[model samples]
Target chain A: MKRTEIRLAGEGGQGLILAGIILAEAAAVYDGANAVQTQSYGPESRGGASKAEVIISEDEIDYPKVNRPDILLVMSQLAHDKYIGDLRPGGTLIADTSNVTPRAPEGARVFELPLTDISVNTTGRAIAANIVALGALVAATGVVSKDAIEKAVAARVPAGTVEVNLRALNAGMEVVRRPATGSGDAH
Target chain B: MVGAGGVRLMQGNEACVEGALAAGLRFFAGYPITPSTEIAELLAERLPQVGGAFIQMEDELASMGAVVGASLAGLKAMTATSGPGFSLKQENIGFAALAEVPCVIVDVQRVGPSTGMPTSPAQGDVMQARWGTHGDHPTVAFTPWSVSETFSLTVTCFNVAEELRTPVILLLDEVIGHMREKVVLPPPEAVTVVDRKKPAVPPGEGYSAYDPGDGDIPPLAAFGDGYRFHVTGLLHDRSGFPTNDPEEAAYLLNRICEKVERRRARLTMIESRDVHGADVVVVAYGCTARPASRAVRMAREAGIRAGLVRLITLWPFPREDVARLTAGARRILVPEMNLGQIVHEVESAVAGRIPVVHLGKVGGVLMTPEEIFEAVKGV
Candidate 1:
């Protein structure tokens, strides 16, 4: 069975843990496959560094820890520096253009998206960046379906917050898919 | 014998999923912790296919609590967690002991007092499994060195849990949890599956779940069976009511401890290879057993006549069997992940006759084969 390993890293308040859980639930429950997700958090929950990894496979997965990440999504510069070395030699790297400023590592596909800006514009929220990044990850890897991710989000999040995160996810996916590359960069 | 079919390359944690499925485990509740998340994740997907239920509870405490609740309702239940999570479940585990609930708990132990190394291996929880919870209670703990053994031992855990009317712990560590190896599933009749004995008396006749009259253990009546009885953490009499009397307290506590301790002959299981004619014995368990096996090969190749003793069951300590095996040996080397847990037991058993040297490593790294061989040098 094919296995896809994805890592989400950011400052603690960005909800990287919840995003990874939704991504894994989408793969395991909705997609009818095996999914293993594990996370490591620092002492503080809000501003300290955090990271989570989700592995989806068609067959039974053996090792849960992702020694080498196939897709690395970093929302902050510290996360990029902390985990860029753990990415596989030829892998996909995605980052939030607003907060993460580190250039992508060589020998891998790189996509820069306005995740934070899109979250602010679409939902007027900064906390929904994780779902937005997850949306971009879904669009980029096609590992888990958009419908599955939405269902997982609806299953997990509060009723009032579901629609905002779904919209943020779609907005993030759309902004990254488009080729517009000028003043909106906000750098 | 285990058949070659259902053969596939699996890690120890994945094998635990297969073993639990084969043993008729229909419900699982767990939290996603390092070294043991695959069991929860695999069950989440597979349980639905098999008409079973899988729930990811709020934390390890809730995960174990939900499993106990599910077990009381007559479902075969289990929970998987690592060292820290296992620590959190201790009080509830003691509750299960007093309540006499039959369920399985898998502790894929990593190095830690508190999150020491999330992704490394350690056998530091050996003694904890025996006495982690408060007060004295009977525990049946199994340790598997290989991926396939992990599967078989999980089934064994369920079987013993039902047979003994208590919680059975499958104590594994990160090396076995993460190591990849091929496993073969046994045929139906080859592996023995034991279910809890039902009460001989009618439901209205007052059946006691904790009643062990003459035998080491008594049958447990599942809840909702129309059997009326009280369960409490305090020491209780034959009718299962709480008591403060010293005589009743001592009787209840000793009965609980001796029920398993008295059956040590049947309870203990070990694996010994080339140990009969050896001058030195290398005693190990869990992941250290793997390298110890390799060390035996290296020592034999170098004409050192070293033998290996691997423990399949860790608690109740397997004292008699260990003593028998080391009867004539000049020295015994005990290798484990922690500083000196199991070595203490071996030294006690050898009675200062055979020099019991310890080879250990902590904080998530495993002791190497060369280090073990060095410990056996003078023997």
Candidate 2:
């Protein structure tokens, strides 16, 4: 009867929807869990606040949309500000420090990482930041296995970009492995 | 029963296309509309690979016309559209209904009166699906709540349409149309397919296209299969020619309506959970059923007797099931994305035997489980 609700919020072109889909595919297809992915987008095609929500459960999922997310990943300042209030108490908040300034809510454990910088430096492209952030989120919370996420990433991304995306995913996990200082105490 | 093997993560729209292909759909004509464009896009890419044809018509009206034409030309044809496009397809849909052309029409519903929120989900077309086309034509509309059901029900739509020789509508709201979920598609061998019953009589052997012998449904003939027949939207006689004789016209119209109405019991599909001995029953369909199901679970945990009766086939509205499910209940709750479309059907079926409450949202936001739970608690 285990269920976890995760929200991935970012600008429209940040690939958050793809990240959510990959995470859902990893959980449902690879991990043998029931998962559903839903998304909301602002009017604009890009540069507008967009959010993708995934609900994973050991049992069949009845309600698909995430209300008070147990895990929230925000890639842009606007997304962080818009969705910060909706995270559950003691929820894990992962944000890209390169683009968003972390604002920890009550009982929220915030992990600030240079997600875009890591993707740009390690993968040589900032376009893989969503994958990088996904790696960090999976590392911070054992929602889905690393192996499953890697397989999902391989199946999802474009053919030629698989290498860089996998590198970006590992770089994201590396950020969480480095030190305890990357995450702030629950406020 | 679909075979239990091939599984994949798929969107509802994508699964619909796969289902259509499995059902022997060889021709598709549609105009791209929000939340429904994926169906056409996939069909455009996949139809050709299967040696089928896909046409992006100038508009929805033309798309429906093309679908009718394709079906007449011995192809299992389909067209997909959203709210505004659905409105435009109504006239031609009625044409298919009257002309007894077997075709599937997929309406991935979006919010609307006219050009409303293009991206938002709404079940506002419940009535439109049944009565959008003019006159008292019998309509068959299947609504699916999940991606897998979308696949199976799309196949069902084609089968029912082909068997009955009438247009069928697969009503899917935007949420189910766009939401991605895991689906294990049964192997193609396990799927059941039904093609339209062609005329048994030879071209010159007194072939009347509208003649069904003892049954209500007539055996349809392809346009160029040596079956010289006239097909028209106007009321026609047994020969398929337009008739001024009142008796022939009445007989034709009654037979068309009875073809579906007489088989209503078999056509209606419903799913009920924990309904027996429950004091409160929630009637829901499509994506709304997801939250209603959760709400029923929560209500049961909280020591409330709540049950769920989900409608899988909307049209030919399962009146008997509605009455049976709500007969002993103290209250019946109908929650839908529209303000109050299906609720009317529930009320009419219940007929004040129970207090039917309408929990509706027209603001394009899905009703959450918490909201439904609160409604259950209030009851």
Candidate 3:
């Protein structure tokens, strides 16, 4: 498809904002797609819920805000409740099993990953969960290459944290090797 | 790519960025907000690439503060903000006016008295841009109707600031800020850049930053140039120190306001389309000016003699031309994103000779062409 809307949601400090920017920069600067990313957060930057929406297309984007998502990734319980209903009938919902007990609408496919635990143990940082969740989404949908996501992450995160985030991405991919949820239903 | 001027498709916000750069702007400080954020984002990226310093300030106040500071340091500095942020920068704007600092402030107006709509467009700041700052100081504000005009007016803003020694406000609505159109980048040699006049006397000689000179404007010596002059918002003498004396204060204030007022010919610019032999005229600026032109064409085609007068520079008000143009017309219609701000100016210029009408909409919605046509029917 020439157009895709991806929504990333989680609690604050999960790097959701940075992940959204990385995806936007990758699409615009690297992949040559017209990408516009918007982010909204609660009052707090450390504890409350946060969401970042990225819209990428071959043509120009008019409204930057996303009313519905083609792919919704939720990293916490609040995120799951906030966005699970926003998924279209045949849309994909990727949830971090350690935190999100997702409830999706009928015909909606849900893929579960232990993103929080993997990020915490692999990177020794709970803050990199957003990066791991992105890797899981890339593995499932293949909208963007894994290497592209890795380079985007490295380019955005602090210089001292790049290697750790890469380890977290690999740890997330290992979880994808095992069958945890629905795989294929083209719509 | 097929338009007048090597036209390239670009957004209005990007055009302002290019205009600031072309005007020899070397310093930019701004806090990112919606609708207006693209200007800062573009400046932050393009400024460094062009050997300019771009700093994202903590808030709009600091952003304006840094701009004034950098300008006093002898660099062409500017800042951009939307509604709520614009409110925060008002005090510094007044400060720049009272201090007679030469700089440009771009207010990419959005909806509200508060943080109402982040993405939508509004033109409610018309009166605010004129009177938001608490003072009787003179002002020069310009509004652009197209992407290309945004660049042209911005360059003019810089030139006016240097020539008049005042802070010029570029009043742009959100629609113009987000709209994309074709514009050709001007060649470097074709653009005329104006720099502030420097002190002619030696360092030790009596060089006042606020003294009256040959043209009633003093030569400003840049900061850190061995010139021991001070700048403050309070009334000061020619040597640039604080003074509470009434005569000195009045003299300083009157000169600052009168200089620009006396030179009205150099400050006012207006564009009229098909105004001759028309009974009805539409006065508009910014994004509204674009659709107003079309509405005038549609009206003319419908057998209603209609024309458009677009304000390229709004502050000097184009009073004399507007008065003359509307004097013979049966009616004048003003359509703005706000309710009755610029309409007041039109009503004043007409002075009851012609029936002045207002078509206004508030809270980020633009006045439709059909609505404008209906308003013009009253003539």
Candidate 4:
């Protein structure tokens, strides 16, 4: 199988790092594929450009960073502005509509959804925005199976918050299943 | 014993803790630092459950000192830190080396001079790790690149330290320390654990702590085991007492280096990929090896004769194995996170036999595969 590079970029407190780990685990552990997850952030624990990258392939993965992401998930305007150009030609872009004004790249399938709003409406927790983003990513791109990601989320998230996080995840899938706002399937 | 035996996703730092525990690490004293703090955090929670001890020392100096003290009490002990903290521990690390205390010091390398970049990866500490502590000493530093290799290499670090009765270093970069991957963990019983040899003679029955007795390693007794023997940083004689005689000091120093240096056959480890007759061999360690390996594969795909030599054991400088592996290559390329640290070692090791190319990078950034492949293609 061809290698799939995914980049999740947002503020540090958005929990995107844990989301990346879960997504990689879904592919590598449950799906029985090779996946490597890496992240880079500022020294502070919050309010900086944070990114978590995952490379999934059928064979051994090398060159762990995501130079050109096949799928780019951006949660905030700063992340979207800095990383929108990094989306590969004919790649998939999933942006949070409420926070980002994405100028969709050419020949890309862009799904601009209200990710933070979905999390707040579904789970009554704003921190589940990352989980909602993951759900949208799996639903729109089909890179990782819903079943595998569900198992990963169940295994990785805190026990008490699992139900709310899963609710947020399914709500994310729901938005894509419905007609996404500003959705362009140019691919 | 931390969890049931199965395949799981883990980070390099967390895996180090599990490997140390499997290797019978019973006591840990460390100051938390970025890129290496996860080991201390996890060990703090897990050690007490296993009836082991964990202490967050006041500083890296105290942490290293405590590790030495604990190991002298006969428990397999360890301390971990990043480059800044690693510098502070050098004095005690040297003392442990001369005194022959069995302990493990883990340095998760970050860009350094004086905290050049916190939480960023760099391989700048290669020379410092080997010759960091004052004076001449043999170093056994294990550099593991991947998450799974981090586990096995950490186990080997403990075993080598215990068997040889010396301090061992587990060197890691920030990338490998923070990177997470799928690792199939082995059961606790499957791992081979080694304990330091103890004195055959009773405490008072003419037992000399530093006497090698025709062997390089003397059977050392724990401090409180009814055996009272001297251990000092000054040159010592066979009876463990400080000796002013030049011959006795030379004997002590020579034996200490020989004990570790002579075990090169057992201590050296490298992973060579497709270097039998390759034209260019890329030599790298720690986090840099990931891209180096990828570059080799890319070069091969592009019909270029490129290979990789991932040096696992960095200290005692595996020159022989390096020379042997890259003998067929026309040129050697070393890409380090530091500005030409390991490149010099390679240049000296090859000794102009193979034309060596140096590619050094800094600034808390990684050498991408494209850049490394370009270096290979340029040759």
Candidate 5:
């Protein structure tokens, strides 16, 4: 089976690290696949666009770090500017229309979503934007099974916020489930 | 969240704390530091519930002191720290070594001469772990490559410390300390826990703190156990009393070194992969082993006969394994996170029998498999 590499990047407090962990757990813990996760550490990760990387494969993961990501999720303009070149030539690019204005790649497929707006509309809090983005990614890519991601979401999110996070997750998933209405775009 | 059945996602540091607890650790004292703080954080909440004690002491020195004191009182004790704190605790660690105290110290390594990078992973402390403390003393260190192995290796650490009545180091790089991985820890019955042997003779009837009594390691008697014995850093005789006599001092030092050296082979642990037949071998440990193994596979697929020797035991230097495993190999490559710390040891172990190539990266990034394979190709 082919290996998939994913990179999630945004501001320091955007919860991309936790999102990376949840995604890895979905693949490895819930779906019984092989996955490895690593995050930027020390000064560069703070007061700047922090980053998290995950690699998933059916075979054993050799190199732990993401050399070139097959999928890139950028939640901020700084992240897009920093990690844009790292995506494969025709890879999938998920951008947050709420903050990022992506400089379109030569042949990349892009999905621009109002992630923060969806989180606000569904959960009444913008902090769940990461979850909403996760849900949308799962819907569009089908990288892991829906059942696997839901189990991971329930297990990872805090107890009191689980219900809302799942609601936010489903709300985000709905955008890609029926994206013809314009909340999400395929360009 | 620990001791849960089946598979679960956990970080390396968290698994280490749970392992120590399962190995009957009942006391912990540490000052929090990057890369290793998670060990102390998890232990603070969990130790008390297990009827153990956890203290966030004023500093790393005090933390080591507390560990030694607690262990002397008959409780399994531990302390965790990073590079800077690790430096601070060296004197106390030396004290524990000279005193023959049974305790565990976990050093989650980071880039450093001193505080170079607080959270970036580096294996710069390899030599420090062996020689940082100020004397000719015995040291045992374990380096685990994965999270699950972190759990089991920690259990082995406590066991070895108690069995030998010596201080042990669980040397962890920052990546292994912080990376979260899927793990299914063994049931309590499956894990082995060792405690220091107590004196069989009646307390006051006949007991010498440093007496070897038919063996190299003297059975340690916990304080307040009605056995009176002295303990000090100064060279001491069988009575545990400080002695300037050259003969007694020489014997005492020899006995301590012999205790660890004699068991070095039995304590040696490693994972060999097609090493005996491969034309080229890579000797790596801890986090570095992951990529080195991958590179070995990459080499073989490309028609290069490459193998790997992943070191589980860093101290006591597995010379025999290195020489024997790579005897047929034409060349040896050593990749490490530091500037050739273990590579030098590998060179020494190989003893010019074969050309040894060194790959060292020290700016806070793990060596990529391609880079390691590139060297294999060059070799």
Candidate 6:
């Protein structure tokens, strides 16, 4: 992409900040592209809204903040309700069906998946939900190669849990490949 | 040139540690504060592995004091802090300035007059970095807009501090300090490393610690070295003894000021683009330069002759360059996170020849490119 802005929004303690850093690393380190990752958090550590913005481009990124996100991935209802209005006209909204009820604006494409459920079922823990969401984000937007994301995850996650996180990532991609009955298009 | 080479994604605070290590920094003492705590945490982890020392002091005062002590013992030392901590460090910073101790102080600024916002960005320390100390002393401050620049400028701050024998400030805001980006650092051997000038005279060979005959900077001798000399905050003569005479005190203070002021031309660093024939010039630094650059591009695309001057070296403020850049422009726009700190300097430089506008944002939110574009169009 010439220049693409991505926003990952969720409540604190969901690892959205780590997900954002991994995505930016995937593009900048593994994909040989330029990327900048910035994050904002509420005063309280947990339960409050947390947002991470990543801007990727083939050239230098001028403005670091995401004014209009081309892709928005949200895992909480509050994040979805707050950030859905900031998506560009033809942007793509990817939300976790387990928590967020999809409310796509006009000309916006919506994709829903059970990101947290898949992580809990595949890895027996909900901590890897952010990695699952990252896998889906890569598959849907093609922002970075799958190999790049996998390498970034391997380098970022703590040792002894890399396998489980990788499994969670692949499970997420599998869900995108086979959409559920009521789920919208994986576009 | 001696680091883990090639391209890697790193945060700004991490880059500062890497840069300090590359500059042969052997000692670090700091107190943890938001937006700047990462630098201390990483240094604590990395310094010991590199055969250096790192100390987490009880507070900012002790941190600065420890850094100064370590520097006097002939190690390149550093400390990092944010708003409140920076305020606490002024006295010791002034001590370093008056005592002619070479050290680097990184102030990763957060929103505040007094604990305003912890995790937010602000350039409010621009004035403090220059004049926070009580007495009149020369100041050298450098600011970077990106992660890679942070690495290079951190090294530069060390070099300048050593060469000039004074404290240097690497000013950063929360936005640049917290952001992550890709950077390709040069090999250790490829980077220029500067060490302080050591004493040439042997012990008891009429060696005076404060004596620099024809030069403003005296050769510093390590404390434990055979060449024993005194160091104090009081104004002293070339023999290293405190002076009560007004003439001797004035000479000592003027020597400190002249040491840096005489080298201002070499110390100033600025990046100017398309400033030759522009109708408006945007002057910005630190994180605000990122959006100011975008605004300049947008204005140019819309057929407005807008140029940009990004100050990489903030203190020893680039007055000559600012005057030359705005000579042909009708107006100048300064967008800072603080309420008109740097704008006042720009106005003084322009001397009312051009209408200088200050676009100040103090709410912890960065000034957006759209806002700057509108300001450019209005100008």
lDDT of 2 by residue, B1-379 (tens): 1112444678999999999999999999999989799999999999999999999999999999999999999999999999899999999999999999999999998889898888888999999999998997989999999999999999999999999999999999989998988889888999999998988888777777788887788888888888888889989988888999999999988988988989999999999999999999999999999999999999999999999999998989999989997788999999999889999989999887789999988978888999999999888
Report the lDDT tens digits of candidate 2 across residue range A1-187: 5789999999999999999999998888887788899988865788877899999999888788999999999999998899899999999999888899978887787788888988888977789999999999998898999988998999899989888899999988878877446442222
List residue ranges in candidate 4 displaced over 4 A: A180-187, B1-5
Candidates sorted on DockQ, descending:
6, 4, 2, 5, 3, 1
Q: Each model's TM-score, in the order given? A: 0.68, 0.97, 0.69, 0.97, 0.97, 0.98
Candidate 2 local lDDT, residue B178: 89
Q: Any runs in candidate 2 off by more than 4 Å, and if so which? A: A179-187, B1-5
lDDT of 2: 0.90
Find the candidate with the highest lDDT and give its number.
Answer: 6
| Model 5: residues with Cα > 4 Å off, grouped in runs | A43-46, A180-182, B1-5
In the range A37-149, model 6's lDDT, one tens digit per residue, is 99988776788889999999999898899989999999999999999999999998899998988889988877888899888888999999999999888878899999899
Superposition error at A147 for model 2 (Å)? 0.9
Best by DockQ: 6
Checking candidate 4 for backbone clashes, the offending pairs are none
Every candidate's DockQ is 0.03, 0.52, 0.04, 0.56, 0.51, 0.59
Candidate numbers sorted by lDDT from highest down = 6, 2, 4, 5, 1, 3
- Candidate 6 local lDDT, residue A17: 95
Instruction: Give the alpha carbon lDDT tens digit for every residue of B101-219 in model 6.
Output: 99999999999999879888999999999999999998999999999999999999999999999999999899999999888988899889999999887877888878987678999
TM-score (0 to 1) of chain B for each candidate? 0.95, 0.98, 0.96, 0.98, 0.98, 0.98
TM-score, chain A, candidate 1 = 0.93
B1-379 per-residue lDDT for model 4 (tens digits): 1112465778999989999999999999999998799999999999999999999989889999999999999899999999999999999999988999999999999988897788788998899999999998878999998899999999999999998889999998889999998889887888999889999988899888899897999988998899988889888999888889999998888988999889998899988999988999999888889889888999999999888999999888899899999999999999998778888889889898888988889999888998899999887
Chain A TM-score for each candidate, in the given order?
Answer: 0.93, 0.94, 0.90, 0.95, 0.94, 0.96
* Model 3 bad stretches (over 4 Å): A1-187, B1-6
The CA lDDT at A82 in model 2 is 90
Model 5 lDDT tens row, B1-379 = 2212577777899989989999999999999999898999999999989999999999999999999999988899999999899999999999989889999999999999887888789999999999989979999999999989999999999999999999999999888888877788888999988888999898888799899889999989989999999999999999999999999999988888889999999889988998867999999999999889889999999999999999999888888987888889899999999887988888888888899999999899888899999999999
